[model samples]
Target: MTSPQILIATLVAAYLYVVTPGPAFLALFTLAASRGRKSGAWFICGHLIGDVVWGALAVAALVGANRLGPTLFEALGFACGLYLVYLGVRALMTRKDALPRTIGAERPLATGMAFGLTNPKSYPVALAMFSAIVAPYIGALKAADAPQMFVAAFLGFLLADATLIFTAGLPAVRKFFLTHGVAVTRVVGVIFIVFGARSIVDAAQGAMRKTA
Candidate 1:
């Protein structure tokens, strides 16, 4: 594949990866529904940091230059899992008459950054997604191409972020969230707990594997 082709492939892969529903999607939707597009935008901005970091790492790994150890990521996964479970519990315990405050509405940027950086699945998912789409071109890729590929991926992230912002801010969507905020919060909470538990289990398994 040529440079342009590789960049386009990376962009498409990144876009698809971001749009796939997961913790970040759930959190973004919740924030946009509860707050507004501006809040969602801020969250996306913060999340971009993680996206870039993980994207770069994925590219590095793909290029046979990965030097980062698995231990650091495993520890981060454990911590992130615990934090997610804590947030889920808080959401689950929200009063019916009260607004849900577990999603860090007051500090959306930080919350988003935390969500993005600490997501245990981010690195592997990114790697898998990129590999699935861009692996065919790996033989054609060169060291100089990494930066351009990353730039394309960044553009993809921005596009997906815009899509989420628009979708979350739609009047009907906002109205639905407003009408059933409590239920939605609880439901999201349950999902978060499940994700957290899965992350915890995966991290533990990874640790055990390492020990053995």
Candidate 2:
């Protein structure tokens, strides 16, 4: 049976891995700027939902699929790169003040779906996470514990993602900063560029890694 201590440790490690800045967080920040905190909260909710779904998919793939299959994985990466560039261009061209408060929850929901559907960089990392950490520990737990463990792991991931998304909502605090300038908008554009570039590089390297 997997040791209880080991299970806890695995969960902790998974939590840490998702906390890093990535396309998902960048998307949340971009949405937060245009939508406000209410929107930011929705974004966080959606981001976590995406993370949980992707994390679970990685876990399943690691068990059966080619966790590192270059052909399939690179396709996913390429799709994500194109999407991020589209998102970046939108941010680059959009006027910060042009966003209407009436945007409602649809924006955040779309961000969440886009994040889940397009972001692939995290999949490899999560595949490793589940195999190296979660597997051994979860292996030890009672069969009855599987559902509880899944719920707990999802929550842990949710907490980490929520923290980042909420922080993106921070600049909305002071009206002076919120209405006075485009610095936040510009910063979001830069963040999107970083995500777009990283995704492209990862897709390219996947091919090289396979051919070499």
Model 1 lDDT-worst window of ten = 64-73
Top-scoring candidate (TM-score): 1
lDDT of 2 by residue, 91-121 (tens): 6676756432333357776666666656665
Error of 2 at 89 (Å): 22
Clashes of each: 0, 2
lDDT of 1 by residue, 1-212 (tens): 33888889899978866875556776777788778988877887788788888887877765553124456545655665676577678778878996534375888899889888998878866665565566446557666777788788889988988888888889798777667767776875675566567557666876798899
> Model 1, residue 201: what's the lDDT?
69
| TM-score, cand. 2 | 0.51
Candidate 2: give the clashing pairs: 1-140, 2-140
Candidate 1 lDDT score at position 21: 53
Scored by lDDT, the top model is 1
